[model samples]
Target: MNPLIRPRRLRTTPAMRRLVAETRIHPAQLILPLFVREGLTAPAPIEAMPGVVQHSLDSLKAATADAAAAGIGGVMLFGIPSTRDAIGSAATDADGILNRATRAVAAEVGDALVVQTDLCLDEFTDHGHCGVLDARGLVDNDATLERYRDMAVAQAEAGSALLGLSGMMDGQVAAVRDALDAAGRTDTAILAYAAKYASAFYGPFREAVDSQLTGDRRTYQQDPANRIEGLREAGLDEAEGADVLMVKPAMSYLDVLADVAATAQVPVWAYQVSGEYAMIEAAARNGWIDRDRAIRESVTGILRAGAGAVLTYWALELAAEGRV
Candidate 1:
């Protein structure tokens, strides 16, 4: 045994492990992702995502207030529109559910928490694509960027401090940034989903958003196999003025998260996406795991992987329970 490299010595006691911990998870380092469905007078439970609900306007306000009170960093809002269209018009409409939800959260939390909104169209589009399709029914990348410009302005006007560009479209961050600047919203920040991969872990998210995705997102989202490509995407986003770079499905891609965090100058974030959350909940319900311990460990793993912050459904609960 190497006496000088005795890692067990540090792990021998709880206080010793805490003192030697290289990473720390705090309530302020977690951002809650909430879904608000339009025309819902009461909260609706997402069947696939147990314990999560699609909030109405009033419920959303109360939830945001509670999140702020619990010392969580922020809320990332997603909207389930009352109607869907080919072009996802609702995503760019000022009165759209997402933008309106942003305003609601902003009004409730104000400057107390950083309010962010999902700047993607999957939840609002009839085809359930992140972008509008062309004549051939394929996602048109350039066309999507144009739509993103409109979306950025709408979200900014709705009082979203940060826009989470989760569409994985080419030139999206730069296009949105230019549009925001042109609209005199230079203060608004862009959080690029720089290394988002097309993963099965997003199944629960589709349920949460009432998505109508007919096919896979492989055309736009990154492939799970390529680490170098993830770095390339993060670099492009950074050059395009993204304030933050994110790796999606954090648990399965911690290596990618760490790689992006190491390479990017901007803050790197990770999304503990819906499927990840559901897995934990499902296992806990089946009595296969200790729920609280699993939640803490999952979040702790994300923080230890070099994420600057994590977007999780458990944000408010974690804060309320003082687990973070």
Candidate 2:
């Protein structure tokens, strides 16, 4: 006989495995990401992301209702404006697509689910940069902060409970926080994309938002080469009063997510971005993997990596089947 206790005893039965499971994923810990295209009468398919569509306003309402009924923690809304400009003026407009969508979701779901909006300019800007550019064609961080300040106020006014600050601009959280306080929108929380990296995983996202980005966001978004830098960014966002900090492209950056989760005093979340979803869908469609099992395993991995919540496109589907 072996000198040590046999570890295989824990795997003897399904009940024993369940008892020893180290991580759990709940429907309440999942958030659904939705895109609403302005001026569209019907939802449009995003070819890059199979089974996902750019929803019209009416469809968006139905989706939000479904998410709320599924007991999802929240919904993060992104808008595809009918027009674009250098400064992304639509982002702050009261009649802007995102603001309108925010109102719709808030009215549809109310306190049943947290209503969150993507507070980024890329979807609204013609050049597709997260911030306004300077004379030298580089992203101006301070200029972007100013825009974010206004965007924060507009989203809060439109009834968003939380603002997802996806733009990786310097001092963005503090700037937005200050603006929210000044505008008497202290109730609106900020979910900062603190450790967001410049990853290729956003390809599907571009199509989902109908992005017209002419250039990359590397000038502002963090480089993928450094892990320590992720921790530093998370610390900065935490210090600036971020209610929650997030790491984008969850599967690829589980290490960074773990580090951020370990040190951050605030809630830590992970975005299972478009590319990750598309890959699984593609493989499943080709019969290379089990779609349902893949979704659960991927989400479970993120949870085991210490993500308090995950933003996944599969939220509604999983919840509908009671698999979350």
Candidate 3:
């Protein structure tokens, strides 16, 4: 049978496919997620995440400089403090590891790239929860909001251009927005983790941040079973003045990402989280797949699913490859 319309014509050449690509990824649209552990003298490789590392302050600056040079969008910084507490006091201290790293990065490449910090207590809290627990040993929502408010101001003061609010607490976006506005840091922006799911896929991330968690965050993070609730959460964050909305563990939540991206008035981004990254890297190392091809295809799928940008560990590598 002869078809009048032929889709194979467009697939004939690489250039033709490139020219017709509906979802193209630019280097400037890729945000790299970085981790810096306090007091480290050198970069330490993360075992589960193979090529990724926990950088020292000096290494962090060097890495950020490299990222800026690569022309990638930005770097999202996560700090592993030398100390932890019940209330995550260091998260609000100007001299804290995260804050200090933020200041250094901004000084090094603020003019070239967006400097973002993880505005969550999980890494700083001894309890391994995103928020402080009450006397009953359960997460205290309102108390957590209070802590987030303080953390927002601190991150802004430390020169973070965007605060990645990953603590999925209720009213978090509003609380942080109000706090930032009141502090006269009106220029700082919030990237709400609007639809972060409580998935087992975050297992490698726990190791990356040295998470002290004994249990899980299923109480706060969205359940994987609910799709409509993702839209609801994204809408709430947007209504609360989120400058950007993100869906985490992106590959597993493409439906949620698409839904949010379709309706979000603000930029919608996705996180290619630690577990997702580990799966590909591990598989590739075992010769089951082409490493480079898998990396490109995975990100392309995420972008095609409707993410305006992606926070990935491969931002630098992709940017250097000159095509993604």
Which candidate achieves the best TM-score against the true structure?
3
Query: Cα miss at 90, model 3 (Å)?
Result: 1.0
Which regions of candidate 3 fall more than 4 Å away from where they truly are?
none
**Model 1 regions more than 4 Å off:** 1-6
- Which stretch of 10 consecutive residues in model 1 shows the poorest summed lDDT? 315-324
Model 2 ranges off by over 4 Å: 2-4
**Alpha carbon lDDT at 81, candidate 3:** 95
Deviation (Å) of 28 in candidate 1: 1.0
lDDT of 2 by residue, 1-324 (tens): 655878898999988988898887788999999999999999898998888888999999998988888898999999999999999999999999999989988999978999999999999998888999899988899988999999999999999999999999999999999999999999999999999999999998988987888768887788998899999999999999999999998999999999999998999999999999999999999999999989999999999898999999998887776564
TM-score of each candidate?
0.96, 0.97, 0.99
Q: Candidate 3, residues 156-228: lDDT per residue as tens digits?
A: 9999999999999999999999999999999999999999999989999899999999988889999999999
Quote the positional error of residue 220 for candidate 3 in Å. 0.3
Error of 3 at 116 (Å): 0.4
Reference-based lDDT, each prediction: 0.91, 0.92, 0.95
Q: What is the lDDT of residue 158 in candidate 3?
A: 94
